[model samples]
Target chain A: MDGDTRETIREVAIDLFSTRGFDQTSLREIAERVGLTKASLYYHYPSKQALLTAIVSPLLDGWRAVTDEAEGMAHTPDNVRHVLTTLLDVMVVNRPLASVLLRDPAGVVAAAGPLWQDMIDVATRLTNWVAGPEPTVAQRLRAIAAMEVLRAAYSSITYLREEVADAEMREVLLDSALGALRR
Target chain B: MDGDTRETIREVAIDLFSTRGFDQTSLREIAERVGLTKASLYYHYPSKQALLTAIVSPLLDGWRAVTDEAEGMAHTPDNVRHVLTTLLDVMVVNRPLASVLLRDPAGVVAAAGPLWQDMIDVATRLTNWVAGPEPTVAQRLRAIAAMEVLRAAYSSITYLREEVADAEMREVLLDSALGALRR
Candidate 1:
């Protein structure tokens, strides 16, 4: 019920879910990690689905902000670079949550159908920013590839356990993402 | 099981699994699609996991072949081109299986743990070929982004339902993939 307990529960859930996968993890595991009883955890979040819904809600809001801001920006290479950088910032700040989300996109889609649809809509808008507001097929493909790089920034095993600090990896990944959209 | 019936079941299962997702799909659903009783379907594949294993096995083999070949070749841009082109061929030949595999990566990882590990190993080998056997950090990142584009060749909703024929999409996707690696 309190902010501290809820935040702690959410963090532990995200850590377990991101590494082991959403299905492989359970509320008990999260509660054990958070040092809470199942009933106590349920008092705050009723279900695993509810916990995930709580985690993703704010992430979706951040993504919405990026996409909405991108809509008013110019569709130039500089714009693409700036957009990808901003997107990567959001993903990195919420790296654990992003990993949990990306870890099992299809499972998430099945479990949270309406939420997944919202994600797809946000993705569509984000890709438009990367590919340009009006993109050719090649540009569209490039945009998607660049987006994958941003997804990889947090989601992939490489980035998740990178020897480099998150700050350095962010710059490196941003460069790679911009390079992907270069063509 | 007869070859015809087994192949038909596999095809229908792949179609359903790829579109709907592996976990969400039930054995009964697959059997219904194939006009078979659950008992009859169980006679071939004891479980949905077995069906997926049967489907992904050949794909794993194909990937193995690509990685093996790339291992022998020089790490030139031309070789990277050849490897990606060949990878695309394998993907196109087994688009449905690729889609199924990509659609629910985490579910597949959970249900088919060792098999998925083998896939990650193969992917690592393949990326080495594309990024050069001894790659720098940037090369490694580019290799991954390029691989993501190849993944897009089949797994993405856009390419999966392109108004363009599979052949045309293949070419378009191939170009996009090569472009990703052009550091």
Candidate 2:
């Protein structure tokens, strides 16, 4: 249960989950790959779901942090730009984590109430950022539109991997998303 | 293999594909749901992959049409807005079809050679549109960003479903996506 062992387990779990899918991957396979006995692995994370949850906690934290920051920002194009830039940076930096969030099992989201709540919280913050303070109905609609676009672009890494550098892509994506928010 | 029956079969296949996934659903299930015998289904579509390709054809055509229109227009914000607005309208009107295009199996993009080619052709046209008649690096980046945001917003029906009506949603999404191309 040292930091290194925990990190190792999380990384292996991400790979297996992404490749084989969340339901198909097993805790035993993850433990064997990490060179840990079942008892030793269980000491760190008691269940498979717990291990999966741990792997995605950082993404949840990052999403929450961005949304929280946007909540306090003044409603202006500049502020909207800053929020979107930050959000895209986090997504690009945590591409694998973001992928997991996008591909979360429908069953898991249904069963895990908190996970769905967190998603709503993050989405609300994103929409609010685009709408700004005291937004018109049109602005709110625009915000929803912007959020959808950003989600699609960021979720598809295969598209990203082929076209441009990650940093450049991030800048472009944020620029487009924020532009959509502006009047 | 009348047009109406062919269209009906495609519609049923899209619903089933989205819900049960491609592999899990079979030709028999589709035929049963559509009230067509397997022989009749085969007359219209030789195989499951053929059925999928037929469903995706309209989406690819729409992409091409938009890209062509954008290419011919002046690269002003107004023109950009017009092109995207038109694209979104078509996309929204054909939501079920667009969803199938977006949700195709990843491996099929390679194995289904014609489908993949059509996608590339459409993407190339889009990139060219953003690049404008003679695009600067920043303009090219803006184009890429605009395309990414537009595609993302159009594909995501689950998140913003409540906020905007289907028709209005298309307008809102297009406006925001075009916002990136504006100065």
Candidate 3:
């Protein structure tokens, strides 16, 4: 029951923060929507920032897991594709949270320092993997290029939601990213 | 003198909107900063939204210019680089306005419909340019992937400001973007 309430609060907060800008949302509104009294909500999360922290925790964990899996794989073209595809899958699946992170990352970084750092750490590792050993300046640039491409596609939900089918978009983006690395 | 006030108002408003956000800025504040009375400001831009429209006008012009230039070019790899490089130059030179456009595009779009349409038209032209006539599924996907990559890098002042020299980031990003488009 305790866990259920906590999860409920987290889910509601994610929806609110994703749709309305984070700064615009309030604790009372979150509690009201969750069907919990203010006192009960406070028991789960002492403040709105705390609730946001709880909400974004899973996303960070998922990113860590994907990067870890990628790190363990061979750095071949096939392995690179797998890693890129998994990253895209995680991105598309968590579209709302991903959108929030990409659109207003500064606010999220301010509120949750460690999580943001972890995300950058993961990005650096992925870049290293793409560059491999003895990377040229150009290769480093490509890695940055590849990251932006994937991030933009996933972050712009309005664009993706309208034009590309989810599965197909993932495949194409991943393949194109891998293709860039090949040359 | 009349044209100068309009330009000054537009510039001040963009700076305020970029730093303090759209909701936090007021027409009076902009007028004061520009050493004009609120009435004078009103004579130039009747509302905050109109001020925003004026700020975004050049961006829309640049977007249209890039697309128009690309349409005239042959759909070859070198032409792709030239068109994209020119587009990146415009974006980098107008970094603050570009940032505002990326951050709260919906607000800008709502206030200025033509501005939003211009962006979409450019993006469509970009995709078409990369894909060319009789494009395969993979080619279409590649175009979107390339576009996203460039958008992400150019839009991110935080990353671009740090990663490359201010004068040279545009050139570097353009090279990287064109590289992504190459087969």
Best by TM-score: 1
- TM-scores of the candidates are 0.89, 0.71, 0.73
Residue B132, model 2: Cα distance from true site in angstroms: 2.0
Q: TM-score of the candidate numbered 1?
A: 0.89
Ranking of all candidate structures by their TM-score, best first: 1, 3, 2
How well does candidate 2 reproduce the true complex, by DockQ?
0.26
Where is model 1 chain A poorest over a 10-residue stretch in terms of lDDT?
Answer: A155-164
Query: What DockQ does candidate 1 have relative to the true complex?
Result: 0.40
Model 3 chain B: ten consecutive residues of lowest lDDT? B153-162
Which regions of candidate 1 fall more than 4 Å away from where they truly are? A1-3, A155-162, B1-3, B158-162
Question: Candidate 2 or 3, higher lDDT?
Answer: 3
Per-residue lDDT of A1-183 in model 2, one digit per residue for the tens? 456888898898788766544544567788799998777888878777687678777777888988888888777767777877787777777777656544434324433458767877677767766676776666776676566546545444543334567766676567666677666
Tens-digit lDDT string for candidate 3 (A1-183): 556888888888788777654555567778899987778888988877787777777777777888888778877877877777888887878877765664444456556668678777776776777666777655666677777767656544543335667877777677666655554
Candidate order by decreasing DockQ: 1, 3, 2
Backbone clashes in model 3, listed as residue pairs: none
lDDT of 3 by residue, B97-164 (tens): 87676655434555566767877766776677767777765566666677766665544444323455
* Candidate 2: residue A142 Cα off by (Å): 1.7
Cα misplacement distance, residue A162 of candidate 2 (Å): 7.6
Q: What is the C-alpha lDDT profile of model 1 across B12-110, one tens digit per residue?
A: 988988887787688889889899988899788777778889999999999999999988988877877888889888987887788887677677888
